[model samples]
Target: MDAIILQVLNGLDKGGAYALIALGLTLVFGTLGVVNFAHGALFMLGAFCAVTFKKIITLEQIVLSKTELSPWGTPLEIRTPYAQQWFGDFGNVLIEYSVPFSLLLAIPVMLFIGIAMERGIIKHFYKRPHAEQILVTFGLAIVLQEIVKAFFGANPNPQPIPQIFMGAADLGVMVGMAENVITYPKWRLVYLFFSLGVIAAVFAFLRFTTFGLVVRAGMSDRETVSMLGINIDKRFTIMFGIAAVVAGLAGVMYTPILPPDYTLGMDFLVLSFIVVVVGGMGSLPGAVLAGFMLGVVQSLASMTEVKDIIPGIDQIIIYLIAVIILLVRPRGLLGKRGVMEN
Candidate 1:
């Protein structure tokens, strides 16, 4: 029972990430009817945004102290004690307090990147066939990845949990498991709740607001929305930005768990697609539910007994489930008949 509980918690964390990314993918596919193969790149960009912000936060202006004379009588330059104290000892010391600060810095930058991609690149491919769109987006993804590599290098960067959130909490007492407390990392728990809050806010915005209504109506029927003089194109561009921000924010919070890496976004791309498909494209509730469901299933597959019974079971579990779901329901669990039809 204790083990099962722990597995459940692990699954929720993984699900949170999958759900967030899948939600963005669904938005693009549902709203624009554009198969955004580059979305994983956006996710990658979001994760790298954390790395960029962290780098910027830790940057220090280099100042030279001219207290000593050189051999040619020029003053010698050395770093000041203040610099050492502020930055820490030795080579390439960081501010040690920059990870959290990255959150704010990453948002606007990511927003702009999202808008730029939508307006500059994605805009041109709207009317193209799915094959062309996929080819271009895939090519764009490679270009984006290469760009990130050029700027940030190819190595994975470390993103540690803040000093304050370095430990785990025991939740056994709350659940009547006095001797079997559920241990959870503080940062991860925070991320789980934060993700939930963001998702709720997104749903609420869409559910109660006119803007959301228009967007939903557009998703359901784009021509009608345009006929109603809603400037559907503009709204969709904004929606693209919103989707980017969501993925970026997910990347921002996910840094502590996986750390920010150039390839991190691509690593989860296939799984995210599966989640969207299984949830039924354009079905927000289904996306959310499937994200958590698959997350839990994948986590459970990691058990030692399960591993012993079937080698590589953990990895294929989610994909297997997706296959089963698709086979069972051609339109996916909650997909509409004409949602993705030509």
Candidate 2:
């Protein structure tokens, strides 16, 4: 029973990431009818944003002291981080929580990148074939990957979780089991809750806000909304930005769990696309639901008993489920009729 609970938690952690990326993919496709193969690159960029913020805050100033000498007779040097000198205790706190703080940097940066990409490149491909769209965006993703490699190298750079969130929590105690029977990382729990909150906020925004109302209408019938003089194009562009932000924030929060490398986005891209397909081509709710569902199944498949029964089951569980879901439900679990029918 404890093992089951642990696996469920693990699934939720993985699902949070899948859901966020898939949600963004669905949003862009649903809103603009554009297949953005480069969406995962935005996730990579968000992780890098955390890396960048940490690097910037920890920038050190070195001073050589003529009067002091080392045991080897070399001049002594004093090195102090600029953030510490500038902001003192507050800077230390910022450095300690750099991953969370990076969200502020990621929001504006990702928003600009998303909008610019849509306006400069994607806009030109609105009427282009899906093949061309996939080709161009995949090429863009490769370019972004190469750029990151050039700047940060090919090695994975791990981000530290906040000091306050470090260590594991004994969840077993909460469920009346023996302590330490179901230990899980505190950060993973934090991430699960954070993902849930973001998902809720997104749903609320779309459900309650006028901007979202217009966007939903545009998604339903673009021509009619345009005929109403609603500037549907502009609204769709903003939705693209919001989608980017969602992906970026997911990346930012994920850095602590997965040390990010230049190829990080590419690694996740295929699986997330699979998630989108299984969820449905453009169904937001389906994306979230399928993400968690697959996550749990994948986690459970990795268990010793399951693995012993079916060798390598964990490796192929998600793909197997995707195939099964596609076979069973052509339009996916919650996909609306007529969507992506063409």
Give the RMSD in angstroms, all C-alphas superposed, for model 1: 4.7
TM-score of each: 0.88, 0.97
Which candidate should be chosen as best, given lDDT against the real structure? Answer: 2
Candidate 2: clashing residue pairs, number: 0
Candidate 1, 1-342: lDDT as tens digits: 778889999999889988988888888887787777788888778777777766655555545556877677867554444434565563233344455566676678777887898899889988889889888888888898889889888888778677778898888877777754688888888878977887898899889999999999998888988998889899888888888888888888888788666677678788898999899988888888888889989999999878999999998999899888888886678888866633
Report clashes for each candidate as comma-separated counts. Answer: 0, 0
Q: For each candidate in the order shown, give its overall lDDT on alpha carbons.
A: 0.81, 0.91
Which segments of candidate 2 are over 4 A away from where they belong?
65-75
Model 1 scores worst on lDDT over the 10 consecutive residues at 90-99
Q: What TM-score quantifies how close candidate 2 is to the native fold? A: 0.97
Per-residue C-alpha lDDT of model 2 across residues 253-291, encoded as one tens digit per residue: 999999999999998888888898898889999999988
> How well does candidate 1 score on lDDT at residue 19?
90
